[model samples]
Structures are given as structure tokens and as C-alpha cells.
Target: MNDIPEPNNESDSSAPIHEARLWRDDGWTARVIKNEDDDGWAVEMIKDGEAEPALVGPWTMGRDKKNPKPLDTGAFNTLVKTASEVLRRHEQQLHALLHKSIAVTTDSGTINVVLDIVPDEDDPYAMLSATDEFGDAIAEVRVAPTFKLTRASAEAWIESGYRKPR
Candidate 1:
């Protein structure tokens, strides 16, 4: 689903309605929308500056059993925490997929080894690079994205003068 645009904060008079169906706060917005499949309500939690909701789940019905329960401070705080954690985990996973690094000690000195992957549907590949303690680039080579980067393999590559892996 596409992210909803952030509401403008400059004009309080222009703020959207804060009924039980929808509400907004400093860093998050909570909306209780109807479930199309059944006679129930679903709540969506969206973070600021994000286009899509971080979470969507079932919501409780009001005492009248005809409307959704109103969003309060306690519930809003819990939703914010849950949504923030979801975003954090997603970012970490993406970083792991795109970049990896390790440290290895050779006869000369310890070098920082890095592998960055370029994910393309037709031509996926990875770049293997090394840097000295002073952050000077020592070598770089392109290899398959699934290439295994081990200490022995990296040492061998360095010994071979950064030859392209076959």
C-alpha cells in the first residue's frame, strides 16, 4: 500500500478531524478503518515521513458495538513503539543484504575487507575491496554476488595482486 502523505502542521485549523475513526500525533498517525470483508474495524499505524503504514491490525469495538474504540495516549504510544521497531529491523535486513565487511590479518598488516552487492535482475554482481589501516584502497575486484568471502580466499586474492575471480 502507498504511504499516506503527512498532514501539514503549519495550520491547526486545517488539521483533519480527530474522531475515533482517525487521529494524528507528533510522529505517528492512527486510523481505524472498516474491514471490507467483515463487520469489523482495522487500525493502521503510520510513521511520519513514511508513505505506507508500518502496521495494520484488528481494532476493538466501542461499548455501543457499532463503532471503533477511540485511540488514547496509552494505545498510541504502544503502536508507535511497535511500528518503530518494525522499521528498524527492516533497515538492518536491507543493509545486510547489500553490504558486508570483515577484518583479516596478512603478513604485512591487517586489512579491512568489504563486499558490496549490486542486485540486478539480469546481471547481479558483487564488488570485493580491501583497504589498509589508513583507509587507503589496496585492491578491488568484481565477482558473482554469491561469492564466498573468507579469510583464506581474501588472502589469496590479495596475494594474487587482486586478480578477478573466475
Candidate 2:
């Protein structure tokens, strides 16, 4: 007879599917699953309400190569921390890639300069824009994604009447 409990149909969708080697916490879930590439164990850490796992790594093997070391408070806590860091770094990197902002002082007034990149498979482009202190858009232009945005470049663009870069 199997000792593990069956999944409760009444449980919330966000709730982790608990088994012998699965654990659910407020913000994350840790589950031990078979490593499809090899005859070993791997652990997947899924964040709350997320469809995909934030981290998937090898699990320590027990005396039997086929069995994984049981998940404990210490191990689970470490996994949670690692997985959270991974998600944090990924978010930071994506933010940097999609958007960037800088403050510049122009003859008119200090303005917030922003560069928003739109990545397309065939053609990538970026939008360069500037806003006044009151959040009014002063100027905007579309440029290549590789265009370098700096104080000098922004000043030049504004001086050129928002002309498309050469």
C-alpha cells in the first residue's frame, strides 16, 4: 500500500501538490522529481502562483543512488533563499534590458531621459524620450536598439528637434 497522501481536490490551486518529498510554504514550494537526463534526482523550486519553476538543480543522493536526501528545514530554507535570489536577479536583468532612465539638465530645465527597447526577432528598435519636471513629454524619437543613450546624446537629440538619429 502507498503511504503518501493523495492530492486533495478541495485544496486551492496555488497550493503545492504534496507528496512524500514535496514541501509547500507561503511563498514557494520545493519538490523532488526524477532527473530526466540521468538516473538521479533533481529539485524544483516554484514560486507562489507561478506556472514555471524559478530554480531546478540536482539533489543530493542518499545511500541508494536512486533515492534523494530527504528535504529538511535547513535544506528547504536554503533552496527557498536560492530560488528567490534567482527570481530577483532575473527580474532585475529584464528591467534593465527593457527600460532605462537617466536625469539630465538641459537649457530648458532638468528632464528625465528614458530609453525603452522593443526587441523584435527581425528588427529591434528603441524609443528615446524626455520628460520635463512636471512629467510632460518634451521630445521623443525612435532609434536603433544599439543606440547609446547618454546625457550628451539626449541633449543633442533635443537640440536637433527630436530628429531621427543617423
Candidate 3:
């Protein structure tokens, strides 16, 4: 039924179970399915409470060479580890893309300028801010998400007396 929500990581949740084609364990589910591009098998690893799979790759063929190897504890554990790494890397990449900072020297001294983007469906924007060496907030302004922060831009902004950029 489409009504039942998938299992979440909780103490009372169902225990890990492994079937020939599906294995659910350690807050991850590994499913072996037919490869759409070829006449081979592929395994997909999906994290708990997530719709999209985090990793998918070719599966080892069974001895018969016509079927996929049954999912086992060792195989399932390896898949979970790989999928977790993939998710972690993706998160790091996203963080670097959305947050940027630069240092520029002014008459008063040097300050660190940072741009933090807040993505919203209806009102997407970014916070352009500056901080002193002691981590004190010097200035901040709302800017378009497309604002590109660089040393030159930061210097110009500070030189303008912290005025909002055009």
C-alpha cells in the first residue's frame, strides 16, 4: 500500500532482513534490480526515509551468471558504507557552493567578508556580511543569490562605507 511510510531509524523499528533481491539494514536499503542500459544487474542503495537512492552500481553475477548474487550481511554493510560516503561528499560540495568568504584590508584593518545563501522556493536570497578579526559583525546586507564575492568586490563594498551594492 502507498499509505505505509517506510521504516525510520528507531529502537522499535523492524529488524534487518535480507531477501534474495532486497536487504534492509543499518538505516539503509539495498535493492538489486535489472540494469536498464544492459542485460546485467545493478544494486541501488537508498538511505532511510529518502526517496532517491544515494548510490547505484553494477552487481556481481551469481555462479549461474544469469542472476544476481543474493544480498548478504557483508555485501549490505559495504553498500551502506559506500552510500554514506557519497551522501557526505555531496553535502560538503553543496556547503562550499552556497557559502563563500574573502578577506580584504581597509583603512581600519582587515575584515573577513562572507556570503551565505538561503535558498527559498518563493524568495531566494543571500546574506552578504562582514566580520572583524575578533569575529564581530561589521556589516551585513541582503543580496541576490547570484552575487559573486571576491577580494575586489569586497574592497569596493567596504570602501563605499558598507553601502549596499547596486
Candidate 4:
């Protein structure tokens, strides 16, 4: 399924003004975008490879409206951690849906873990991984899949844990 599509014509602004900015922590990278139309912002965390955004939610405006809280060591660190978890969970769900045949024997018995991976256009190494369960890798193709692996449930499968059968 088509979750979040990149803006077709991103406004050319030096700063993230109304665009998403990339943040890096340890090895994970997160994209923080300003929601000009809304009162909040959205964050997307990416790991190794996957499709879609890891965490897409509201962001605080700190204390000022014109200025957002600066991206510092502590703030960046916290964002990375939270974003990573979001990505991880998303990856697990996507995996489950992809491989419905593969029964994940959880305590519930025969639980499924689906996942999907959205690749980065600029860089071939980045992708968004989300899953249904917790830590399963399902749709792990390159940045972008040659074929279509689209669906919310299927997307959730990618989020779940559906690796490329490898």
C-alpha cells in the first residue's frame, strides 16, 4: 500500500523550512519534517533498508513558534532512540503480512510477522523497515522493490517482519 509519498516538488529552501531534514545517531538516520499545514511536525526513522516512515507523528514547537528546539546531542539522541523503536516495530508488522504462510510460533501459536522495506532514492543503502510482530525482517529488497509490495496490511507486513525470504 502507498503509505507516505515523498513530496513531488519540494520547496527549495536552505533550511528544512517546510521540508524534512535528516538526522543521524550511532548508525540510524531519522528524518524530521515540518508540517507547515499542521500545528506539529513529523519524524521518520530509517535503518539499514526499508520503505515508508518509521515514526510519523506530532512534534512539539518547543517554547517558540518561529524557532524549533535546536537539534542537540541530547535531543538528537532521544529522537534517534524513539525513532528507531518505531522503525523496528513497523518493520516487524510488514514482515508478518508478507509471509502469511510462515507461521510464527509465538506464545499465541501460529502468529504471523509481516514486514516491508522502502528504499531511499538518493542513497541505495537506506530503507524503511517495519513489522507486525517485533523483530522480524520481511520485505528486504534494495532501496525500492522492482515489483509492487503495496498494502496497509502488507505495508504493515513490511513493518512487521517480512524479509526477502533470505
What order do you get sorting by lDDT, best first?
A: 3, 2, 1, 4
Cα lDDT tens digits, model 2, 1-166, are 4332333558875675445478776677888887879978888988877889999999999877668888877888899999999999998999898898888787788888899999989999999898998999888888899988877887777778778777
TM-score, every prediction: 0.73, 0.70, 0.89, 0.39
For model 1, how many clashes? 2
Of the candidates shown, which would achieve the greatest lDDT relative to the real structure?
3
What's model 1's overall lDDT? 0.80
Candidate 4 off by > 4 Å: 1-22, 48-52, 100-166
State which candidate, 1 or 2, has the greater TM-score: 1
List where candidate 2 sits over 4 angstroms from the true fold. 1-9, 14-19, 102-110, 117-127, 132-153, 163-166
Q: Clash totals for all models, in order?
A: 2, 0, 0, 71
lDDT for model 4, on a 0 to 1 scale?
0.48
What is the model-wide C-alpha lDDT for candidate 3?
A: 0.87
Pull out the clashing pairs in model 2. none
Q: Which stretches of candidate 3 lie over 4 Å from their true place?
A: 1-14
Q: Quantify all predictions' global Cα lDDT against the true fold.
A: 0.80, 0.82, 0.87, 0.48
Tell me the spans in candidate 1 whose CA falls farther than 4 Å from its real position: 1-17, 35-39, 48-51, 120-124
**lDDT of candidate 4 over 53-101, digit per residue (tens):** 5556555565767434444566567876787777678668777534333
Q: Which ten residues in a row have the lowest lDDT in candidate 4?
A: 11-20
Error of 1 at 40 (Å): 3.9
lDDT at 132 for candidate 1?
Answer: 92
